[model samples]
Target: MTATRVILIRHGRTTWNASARFQGQTDVPLDDVGVGQAQRTADALYQELVGTDVRILSSDLSRAAQTARALATKLHVEVGLDERLREISAGEWEGLTRDEIVKGWGDDYDAWRRGDVELRLGGNGETRNEAAERCASAIVEAEKAMDSGTLVCVGHGGALRGAIFSLLGTPAWPWHAMEGLRNAHWAELQYTGQGWRLSRYNVN
Candidate 1:
């Protein structure tokens, strides 16, 4: 049976996040603020899921792994790492600022930013559809692996958003319709047996 609930958490903020740089698959560690945020999130999550069977899975990236570890430690559960949950690769654009990307790629970058699902990021990165498929597959696989209870997946914002849309069978283009997830915040989905339904969004 699938997991009864799923929580998709965006990793805590990083220095790059603060500076508005594209992190891509970079292994950036969490900044001090991020660490604090993770701890607070962990405490809140522990209180909420104390008696529930909760499993945590995270992207292999340092930022995501660190966030997951905080919660898993609080819950006294080991975290599982999944590469498939990593951020959408920024390729050559990793570490670049929005302005830099705009100056370099011009209209192409604008189109991608506006959510042209077919366009690969960073001139050579995975398309939104590709990222969505992989991220959604990871979540679905984790859900099927669990007999019940909640599954917490810690990952990057873009990838997490794509997973949500993908799971709901919604179009990824014009992704701006939804705002990006705040750091250390999460979205919740309930399995309705037939499909997944969003229960909460952008919750800390």
Candidate 2:
């Protein structure tokens, strides 16, 4: 049997992203530049997926949803919003920049980057593991729902990376060692009955 394929794309950069802010779970809309990036991404996918039947899925957050919408328009397909695909909740760190985080939380920011889950980013923030699990479950569920053909999931940077790593069987502890996936980048995975195998990763 042919394996099911999933194409995962990260949403275009946002104003907060340009400003180097922690935008987790924040409903920030795309700026003009981001919209342009989305259009470029859609165009790239258009050429790649020509004559292919595919479904688009996106995080319910506006940034991801907007990106998916652009791609869906290009592909002439409807976009499905899934809350499980949303960015990791950064809670109190939501709108703060890196410098601000260092000034406010000091070593906490460093610890978080170093993959320390115990060092939460203020109240209500999600651990890296929590984000990974949520992303993994969503991808698994989506694969099960699709009968055949390609599927696109547009989400945030961290969440997208987490999902891809999980699907590739990469351990959570060394996730930081993995290279960061760029804005509007695409990763592909093939799902057989036994499990998922990485076909491509961090492709722009």
Candidate 3:
């Protein structure tokens, strides 16, 4: 079977992420520790992907773009930004800390934790299904363009999980069961002519 490999990398932690805030759609910069994490990830990818032809892709957001840039530089390749790879829109919860969200939007926050896609945070936000569809479409497009080499996509944690689960044909709702992905963590996938298959998930 013809197989194409894809590497899904989560962006480094942002300032809001360090503060345990809901960072969806918020343009936050990476903290010092996050920068270090990105550097280390770049180094690892450099060693692992040397002399291999790989297409580099990342979310349009700055945080993910920055992390992708690091890897692209190490691999000497240009990075491509895909809007479909953006994070889930968190609406009014964007910059709010966990405790602050609990205090301000208690019931909604609880429902979110319970994986209720219908539960809107504040007034408007991208539901889990919406995020999954976008991410999955991006993956399909990437797979079609990739022939024999690797395709590296750097995106947000939530969106990355959504993409992985969607590719696995799992429900988007119960995202919590998918486990949290650390900054700079990676998920490896192999795509056959039929579809993509997961080889690993959340590897740092």
Best model per lDDT: 1
Compared with the true structure, what per-residue lDDT tens digits does model 2 show for residues 1-204?
A: 442889888888899989998999989988888898888989988898868878888999998999999989977899998988998899899999888888888888888878774555556798776787798788788777877888888898888777777777774557577777788888888987777888888886
Model 3, range 51-86, lDDT digits (tens) per residue? 987889889999899999999988889999999999
- TM of each candidate vs. truth: 0.97, 0.93, 0.94
Score candidate 2 by TM-score against the native: 0.93
| lDDT, ranked from best to worst | 1, 3, 2
State how far residue 161 of model 3 sits from its true place (Å).
0.5
- lDDT of candidate 1 over 52-159, digit per residue (tens): 999999999999999999999888999999999999987889999999999998887988877888888888888888888899999999999999899999999999
Clashing pairs in 1: none
Query: Would you list the C-alpha lDDT of every candidate in the order shown?
Result: 0.91, 0.83, 0.83
lDDT score, residue 6, model 3? Answer: 87
